[model samples]
Target: MNGNVEVVVVGGGYGGVTAANRLARRDGVSVTLVNPRPEFVSRIRLHQLVTGSDDAVEGFGEVLGGDVRLVVDTATRIDAAGRRVSLAGGGTLSYDYLVYAVGSGAADPGVPGVPGAAEFAHWVSDFEGAGRLRSALDTASASASVTVVGSGPTGLETAAELAEAGREVTLVCGRVLGPSLHARVRRPVARRLAELGVTVLEGAGARVTEVTRDAVQLDDGRSLPSAVTVWTAGFRVPDLAARSGLRTDADGRLLTDTTPTSVDDERIVAAGDAAVMPDHPFRMSCQAAVQLGPAAADTIRRRIAGKTPAPVRMFFAGQSLSLGRNEGVTQFSYPNDKVNALSISGRTGAGVKEIACRFTLNKLVSGARKASSRGSHGDSGNRLETPQPEHPTTPHGTRRSA
Candidate 1:
């Protein structure tokens, strides 16, 4: 608090946390993290949360590295040229560098007269929405009809979970299920859906034009009666970046270079769903966010040290989809969007998805611990010459060891 911090990371999602931890571990840097939420919500598990399988929230104190100071406040504006950020709590923070990892929100399709859609359609994209969806599911009758809009992973997962829980589920897809999947993978996925008792409507081009308490109207002049509706069509970035005069895509995502730095200002960096890397913008997924986090941190570290940052290497690790508690699909993709010959599904696939989720959380925790340990040692070394007072350290000391 005495001097200007070296780096300020805005947002507390996967990308923001990773960048903050990595930056704080560097030899000569101070890191401050800003976000409205005090906890990190595991968005990937949101589907499961809606199905009452897992709690989606985790405490920030348990996740953030010791070296990183947490500021629980919304970022209102960015003064990139001045290296300062305005917080909603009437406080301003200045930094030598800034990272923007503010994520995206569910996109609203511009269908006319979609009454009650915003108020009734439940989305699993965020924790609050998921909680509401879960509560509604609990109150829904045993034979209640559940309609899911969108064919992506979230929609499929929600549909399958409801079906597995004994609720009648109908999945409405504008295109074929798993539109991005290869035909070979799509067939098995469809089969799995059938086995789970989920009615799959394909190529319906059914756009939800209106939502009533018990029914939804589609563009094709069809009405589907349902007790609940879940929407997972697409996502849109927050308007913070655009309103701050940063260069953004038509969808309001901050435009960044390959290294994840804002094209308009190198001092401003972005990651997660809020950033669109112009040279090689990949789909907005947790997979990309995890990689982008450390990549952004490295770029900032290099710049602060006056060294040229290395170019980012974008790679598609793979895609994993969960059908429910005991079924899933894992499609491996090559670096050039080529589908791998091998695909996993069913019980084995569920195991794989579970492992992947655990791996992601474990990676975050491990990275944070490493950063915290490094910071503590560095601090101890600095204070070695000034202190002579001795006190017994408690088991839960201020300093944490890996």
Candidate 2:
């Protein structure tokens, strides 16, 4: 490439910020990050935002690289054939390469027979929804009942946080609590929730069939009074890739080969919850997003140098769940994400969880500093070093070429 290589990173979450910083390290590479909000959202602490424990947002100046152009607007469409991205704020950006990292949000409440859920239940998956729920809680009476639907980590964290804050909380697990956790680890989590005075509802009978303004109807002919309903179930990604005629999985995540290059176009790569690497198929967690972001950026850098890009490598350490401000659990796992027997709980676990959150922010800040320092010397060979797990293991599968 004779001139500057333009790269547009869509979304400013963990993935986008990291990718922008990494790409900006190389000379003659221009990085532009397009995000709806000017501030960076720490999504891992969203549950804390609901309870007024943390703000869950940071100034973009703290995380994003100085050399990266920040576009405070939404990306409406991607014209892949023309190498252009249409913005909702009225304009188009021509890119030599694009990185798709639009994160995820709560799944819509439109179950088969579950009516009124979309209108009645509140969620805390995104920043806007979290703010709305916090306001609703402020005005509600102290005696109002709060019901959290879903047994996933989000549900567990939300229920525990609210219960610890003196709210009459009920966790309605449609089936079992911590479905993905090993049975041994789930035992301690259940004990902590019980200590916090949360009403845990399990079994088929606990499944919520309908959500109303005042109560929720269960599958087993039971009606529970719920003044504030918080839905924290599954997550759904943006439809940007699918709408743009790019190859996507059924869930609308951009379908990429092992190199994380879109099968539809080699110049378009993806990361975070918005991308699906067919061979790896990792879960949508910050653990994966932080690593995949740099991997995607590395692919673009390699292509710019006329070299073959290496396949993406991802490793998971474990699941970190904060029960509340004081208590939490760290369920360690293998690189493949299968829960192992080792675990930590109580206050020690809380410390570990807090460190993980801070580590993400620190990682971005440090990466930006390194990139900025290297850019000053006019050297493109200096690579941004991303931290790896202590015990790394190879993901089982052959690479899928784009």
- Top lDDT prediction, candidate number: 2
Candidate 2: tens digits of C-alpha lDDT, residues 89-203: 5667779999999999988877444798998999999999999999999999988999999979899999999999999999999889988788889998999999999999997
**Scored by CA lDDT, what does every candidate get?**
0.79, 0.86
Off by over 4 Å in 2: 111-113, 375-402
Question: What's the distance in Å from true for residue 70, model 1?
Answer: 1.0
- Compose the digit string of candidate 1's lDDT tens values, residues 199-300: 888775566777777887887888899889888888877788988899898888999888888999988877788999777868888988888899999998
Q: Single out the weakest 10-residue window by summed lDDT for candidate 2.
A: 393-402
Error of 1 at 299 (Å): 0.4
TM-score (C-alpha, index-matched) for candidate 1: 0.90
**Number of clashes found in candidate 1:** 0
TM-scores for candidates 1 onward, in order = 0.90, 0.92
The whole-model C-alpha lDDT of candidate 1 against the native structure comes to: 0.79
